[model samples]
Target: MKMSKVFRLLFIGMVALSVLLAGCSKSNQATSGDKKPNELVVGQDANPTTMDPHDTQDTLAYGIQKTMYEGLLGFDKDMQVIPVLAEAMPELAKDAKSLTFKLKKGIKFQDGTDFNADAVKANIDRLKDPANKLKRASLYAAIDHVEIVDPYTVKIVLNKPFAPIVQAFAHPAGLMISPKAIKEYGKDLNRHPVGTGPFQFVEWKDGQYVVVKKFDGYWDKANAAKVEKITFKPVPETASRIAMLKTGEAQFIYPLPPEQTESVKGDSNVVVDKAQSTIIRYVVFNVNQKPFDDKRVRQALNYAVDKDALNKVVYRGFASAPESAIAPKVWGFQKQQMYAYDVEKAKKLLAEAGLPNGFEITLWTPNDTIRAKIAEFVQQQWQIIGVKATIQQMEFVTLTNQLSLKPEESKLQAAVSGWSPSTGEADWGIRPLLSKNMFPTAGFNSGFYVNDQLDKYVVTGLESGDEKERLNAYAEAQKVIVEDAPWVFLTVPDNLVGKRKNLSGVYVLPDATQDVVHAEFK
Candidate 1:
């Protein structure tokens, strides 16, 4: 009886050992096959409206496009232009009216088509084509035509000498798309974009997330993506986005509200990064509208704005008071205090404009938390000057459309808007906001403020080959615009970004776009 009992015990032990070995083998296979930890997830406030690079001007779309598209040139973290798909910087002709670029050979789009000079020409042609009506069509107005010198070389002939054209190529207007894909998909190309970027689009679940995976066959594989996959999820609510970052549900979040920066710093798993940005937040006057047409009234409004108070209250002292329409980061920004906050001065200007009793006006602002606060503050301050201001809120996209309408068809008296010149040049900062050429349908000029003297200086600045001469022209333009008070120059907010402590390689460009090409979790 003792021998039989010992045999039973030995059999049971052997069975238990086999079960343990099988469980270990299964776990190893599953880990190797599927649940890898090389994926990164990011949360942002908005979803991209379209994938077609040329069809949209939304910053969110540009952020997503950067992952999949490669322009002829790109900007470094310091806002300097660098060649991306081009073998080198373009060779400028002596007159600066033409540019020749040599394309990098052996590069192919995600759709497996060769990227050649023809592809570049096709993109420019599409952008300049009036039928397409791209929101950024005016950006390429200087380009007269494109000529292909060879399979790898192309020449761009300009109608005028445009000094900022090269930098403009680094903007979204310069992003290249697969011509083959465009032809096949037509207007539906936005749904299935193909590019020669480091990441290839996998799927986009509307209002939820966009998924992209590393393209192993990318041309520059050495500096290619470190993470295997990236999932960009749209968490519009600020609290929810912050919660995701804290819980590791999202590895990165951008435009981190300044009020929450301190709270985020207390979290052990998150880090906050701040950088000087070229973004300018200001209130645009509808120059075509009533009392605003009078320079005295506009100047009165500028003097009435308490920018210092706004920075401290709305931005939590994280923003700098703007001295000019162009942010200080732009090349030719000149420091000017044309209209300092002085309630007495504002009242005097209003009386000088024949309105001792301030009139009623409506101020439009987007339905954003910080902007809402700014609008309310402006209303309270204007009341001190005897002006009755009513605040209206709308979705950002709707607000943009409302600003785009013709003055006669629109009811925009004043609107709070922001501008970030994508090219990091003073010309872009000034021309789109003050030039008559940009009025009516041009996407950037919401104010329709026109001054012939400003236009002359802007044109001269664009055509000048000498750097010093260009700077002088832009400086003069800035001085005139500040005096004109087309906009109530407000603040230059720093680009605040939040990320998990374990994340690395995330970069914020000067224009406030996130560079995720090399982003990864440590």
Candidate 2:
């Protein structure tokens, strides 16, 4: 699908206007050169909505929380599961129904609490408690209970055979919090964190910065922090973040804006780091709403837009069109045929659906540059097919609230968002977003997408450990989802970062989380 001349001109004009606005905007003059050598300041795109790991759904918060918390299992840069607090890899039962882990002894939380089987059981119990209402409960719903075998050993008994257990523990939601703190702070634990990781939480000045200091008694000395203190500062403006990096105001920054990648590459003071990411972007349709409820209307929307153009224009070629519902970097990802761009086909589908004149919709998007651009481009494409789209851009928090509305109460027609399988597996990639059991307030199924066949296929994949069986199940699942057209699949963006030349051991993981524990200045 080639981009129309008018679309290309609109994109160029938008880019020029953004550049002009950036030039006219005032810049902050703060510099980090005078700071102590042992302190590392990092800039992120936005402030995390919450500091509590279990309560957070945002990626930036998880990255910062990881520095303070340690999970039984962890993921390396390649997204492979490895042991962090556990003595070694867990022992799985033959039926894939249970997993046993040997806890590492002589470990203590930052608050001087003992780390043992009891602590593990306590955390799991809290998550499983229906009264707590944690958003991640669905991921662990298969767990029947946690059995304490000994002071240093624990067993997780599952209600059924679940294949993604290990990957689930490696997720940020899987990161363990201090049981003692859970008791002491209770609901206030979101502001107070105690963990056994290399860094201990210092303070979180909401909407400004989160501070952490080194833990002198960390268990893993080899992976311990090199710096005494690390500060995560939220700098929302892309140009301001880049300027800070060049001026030494920030030593590192996650998500170097895609449009600025080439410009940053030529800078001698900054080095560009890239990782294959599991983050997939798409526009989700509210299937419970009018026009979108019809499969033909959904499929027509997918056919109207050119995904290749979206990647090139919005991502500056830093992304690729998705071949599967999940990114190829994730485990169990299977390739499937995607929709080809066809304006005429979209028109025909709309006519067949008894709406030859098309319909009007309120398209919601966060006020981020990339998402806004994608929304604008899509709006133009849909206009060609007689669809009138009114874009409503809001703050990230506001957008989240709107998306989180109950299906019956929601007025949203469509929304532009992205999902990263923080666990780096297909189960985490597809289940929460597409499954019938994951509707809002439960999981992230905000679009209210449901298909009986898809739900069964997802369960079938989880019920076995056999590679071929899971592959076949996921392949069928992908085909069903594509045919349903619940979303206009966009791109799997590359994880790009910018850091000072002297910074060492800081990089974005394939799951879009940061491994900043071993970071230091050269």
* Number of the top-ranking candidate, with lDDT as the measure: 2
Each candidate structure's TM-score, on Cα atoms with residue i matched to residue i, is: 0.90, 0.91
lDDT for each candidate structure? 0.85, 0.86
lDDT of 2 by residue, 112-190 (tens): 8899999999888888887887878888899999999999999999999888888888888877888989999999988
User: Poorest 10 consecutive residues of model 2 by lDDT?
Assistant: 26-35
Candidate 1 C-alpha error for residue 232, in Å: 2.9
State the lDDT of candidate 1 residue by residue for 367-450, as single tens digits.
767777889989998999999999998766578778877657878889988888888899878887678878756656778888
lDDT of 2 at 176: 86
- Candidate 2 regions exceeding 4 Å error are 1-36
